[model samples]
Target: MEEKKFDINTLIGFVLMGAIMFWWIYSTQPTPEEIEAEKNKTEQVKEDTTVTNPTTSEIILQAGDSVTLAKAQTELGSFAYSTTLPSAKDSETILENDLLKLVISNKGGQIKEALIKKYVTYDSLPLYMIKDNNASFNINFGTTDNRTLNTKDLFFEPSLTKKGETQILSMKLKVSNNQFLEYQYEIKPNEYMVDFNIRSQGLSNVFNSSQQINLDWNLEGFRHEKSIRYENQQTELYYEKDDENIDYLSIGGEDDAEENDVNWIAYKQHFFSSILISEQAFDNIKLKSKTLVEDEEVDTTFTKAFYLKAPLALQGGELNYNMNWYIGPNDYQILKKYDRNIKEITNLGWGIFGFINRAVFIPVFNFLKGFIGNYGIIIILLTIVVRIIMSPLVYKSYLSSAKMKVLKPEMDEIAKKYPKKEDAMKRQQETMALQSKAGVSPLSGCIPALIQAPVFFALFRFFPSNIDLRQKGFLWADDLSAYDSVFKLPFKIPFYGDHISLFPILASIAIFFYMKMTQSQQMNMQQPTQEGMPDMQKMMKMMMYLSPIMMLVFFNMYASGLSLYYFVSNLLTITIMLVIKNFILDEDKIHAKIQENKKKPKKESKFRQRLNDAMKQAQEQQAQQQKRKK
Candidate 1:
């Protein structure tokens, strides 16, 4: 048996990984006091919302007091007359078309439930954009009678009407029929967008001259995907600045930003979203996204909690604002149709990589999707197309590697001639001279590989963000957008997760062999590097194993579609490598060509002359230092 090599870097890596695992496990476990607090935690979502409202304890106390009209009037002030409205006893009115179902609540004149009729959750339950009665959209302002009020605390009368193919619902918090605050909603057939308008009808005197009217919208995004951690990483708060670029909150932790000239705010989920758009620009916006989980299984009900405090751009003394609400999937095709830059919210990538995905990958993928029923087959075909396009680059990189391999014997001879550490600079100078004479640039191999990186990254962004892959089945994977667990472990394996996914395992295996083949090409030259440099061979060997292990652990809970792409990509790479090595490359011919080129008159460029001069100066300095020490 071969003795294992002792590597300090590998040892340190293991120690750090062990420390991280212990820290993660320790940090995620709830304390005894936290368990009790979670038991008593209010279902009303008071903890996440920053809006000034009666707490759960305060509400309970009021309910226990047997409050009367006098007590209500004192608390509600001029808006107290709304308690006796026509729809005071009514709970909800439905405004829906074929694509969407929205329930407008009589209590707050806000959307109580919004469900997408075409889709369902991972477990085949009705897909709700807003449910559990936990979402709140309240307008906060002061009344003329020196009383502050919130729309959620008042009841509104609801009226549902239909015009042509459009359904409309108007909820009015009537001081009377002549003076009221109205929330009008219009839903058109076969549309996911809802036209919403909040305008007070004739309330100039009943309202005070308050410039501090604020709109507080809070939502706890429901978990629809199977992997909470995977889904939460995708879920975040995104906003577009008016006449500016799109920006988003950090996904890994709590994020807060004060934005100006806001065009819209999207409480984006993994696949679904609830976006609020202002027809006019909004100024002075306070947006926040609080990550609801430190561990995947700890908080599974929701992905992230969102809070927004935006001052309404009031026209007159009353609220008069036109807006549209988008409560649907984060589909690229659908979102791109909107004039606003809502398409950016779907994470394709950024800069040139994003351009590559949109300009090249999306069109090709969608074209393949047009006739192909099997997504797995489509992915395989896509990989083949990508490999064919990148074949020239592959050939060039392989040719460069072969040239270096041909030069290995000479490199080993040079290493033997200068065996002492003191001759390191001379060895490097000779190596450069030899490479220059043979016309083999060291950077030739690196440039092609670097150019190919964007395509891989573009596809990495393409897979998970591709909504077409959701719930699509292939082989053992029932949902291509989620993990394909082949076997379930009895207990968690720290960083490796609780289940074994076959696609990622296959992908990791392919990566290991692919790296091994590449490393074999590089391991030919037994040459020592500069005196103070790190051991490149040991580092490369360490990476050859570490990379696959990392891939296995990371993609364990990631989207199966991404894993499938990587698996097919690596398999194609291995096949291409084999074809190039066995049939195309002629080692004997390459060696002959190198010898002929080296025999031809060598031209030393300015860069080479400067480098040789610098090395000679360094050698002289080293000699002087050695003599002084002696």
Candidate 2:
């Protein structure tokens, strides 16, 4: 059998195919070495982390103990029906003996129209309920939309303990024979947390059994009338959860047609989850669904806990629930100690990729933040550090682009010599040959740039979040948590909203200059493509105009800190590119290198030979079929 000769075109096709394969593999596949290292690291992490449990104790106050309801406003009833309403505004209440510190304000004085001040949930403005599973419980009476719910009418009482710690004053209320029987509050302190328990005396259990005592932490004047959406927000981290339990008991609420009604909004720095407790059992519960609100792209989980079988019931004798509340920074070190994975609330985003983000990106950010006090500075330092790490790849990419730049003249000549569409194929072959002779891959520069895209995007998502940056101001910016707009407009622009940010404008300008410098190198080459050269040029010009414009508009209302990071990174990249072009690349030496490659031994690749054979066989079959038809 005669040996098959490979066409240059065929070899180029194989090369393109190989490049696509390599890119696909590179994007998706972790190298075996990386995989092995990851596995070892995972094992080490597991070995290092020890499980710890967080527990809280409850205290029961005796009736004889004279408790000062320091912040008590009023107690209403005629011996039979009595209830204490907290004072709306008496600074700090000091409960002494039997006298209540009542800060009476006409604003909040009714029990039916009271407001819930401090019942903890996952969200800031959460819903209140008469009964846990009652469908009416879905109506959110949170303080919003010009509605004011006075804390006085909302809370029973507020008091400071003997230790000076703030505590809530509440009476054990019982309803019997169409009468409301109320008892005063008592406080006792213990190590770790303060707990207040009130007991009712002379009141018998109704229905000769357990009567579920439903307390009202009502939002008197609050109403939900609108929904909201966000272009960008904090990312939440998610964990693999078994969502088999029923968390949604009764999803009732008037659908606010306005897009502004938030199904759920991402709180400042916490995860929002809905837990469904049954009227029967309210204590023992299990995590149910890990969900994200519709159209909300958060980084972490929106989990719901379902009381295994309805809420734990309270026996008529008495019902007691010890709530553990955390009211400080969500430090992972402390959160992880609880073992509840409450630390996961620091929104990392979801799925396997989310795990990688939480396990990798977050830790890296935290580590870097330790040294770099300022977050903006940390971003800059991180960018420089990443560039340094990827320097070897960057050097190779620059060398390849430089080689292509040097061959522009010769490549232009080949294009001019072959104007016909058929000869256009032949011209491309010569260009490839020229590129190969120059010891450069046309695609080499592109791959490294592509590799950096993920890191860039990951950081973009990371910084807007990373609560450590919240309220931390760098320069002219006030709060890094929100956008640092130099000026606010009275009107809103579509998609962009109403604000003017300087950082994105500076960034876009840097990008423009960077693109301009890159394309300028190709300007000396006179040859153009066979078709649509004018259109390509037009597209390039359009990109130059469009990209910066879009950035200026989109980032005008985004966090200035994020925009600053991109701006600094772009400026740095431009400087690096300039350095490579000016100092590292020599056009004369590159041309000489190309000439040297032309004299080396050239061998036909087996893949190239196979491709040519396939193409030839296809041509032969097509010719035979045409002849038969004729």
Query: Highest TM-score, which number?
Result: 1
Give per-model TM-scores: 0.85, 0.54
Q: What is the lDDT of residue 294 in candidate 2?
A: 42
Any runs in candidate 1 off by more than 4 Å, and if so which? 1-75, 524-527, 602-630
lDDT of each: 0.85, 0.45
TM for candidate 2 is 0.54
* Tens digit per residue, CA lDDT, model 2, 231-332: 113222122223212112211121111111111111112212211111122332221222234432223222221112112233354334443323223444
In candidate 1, how many Å is residue 472 off?
0.6
- Can you write out model 1's per-residue Cα lDDT over 1-630, one digit (the tens) per residue? 999899999989999999999999999999999888886776446653654465322332343244534455667766656654446543788888888999888778888899999888899999998888658999988778887778887778888888998988888888877889999999999889889989997777777776478899999988898888889999999999987689999998899999899999999998899999888878989999998877895547778899999987556677899999999989998998888788888999998889999999899999999999999889889999999999888888888888888998888788899889888878888988899899887677778889999998898889899989999999999999999999999888887788999999999999999889878766643346667888878887898999899989999998998899899899999999899999999989988999999999998899889989999999899889989999
lDDT of 2: 0.45
**Whole-model alpha-carbon lDDT for candidate 1:** 0.85
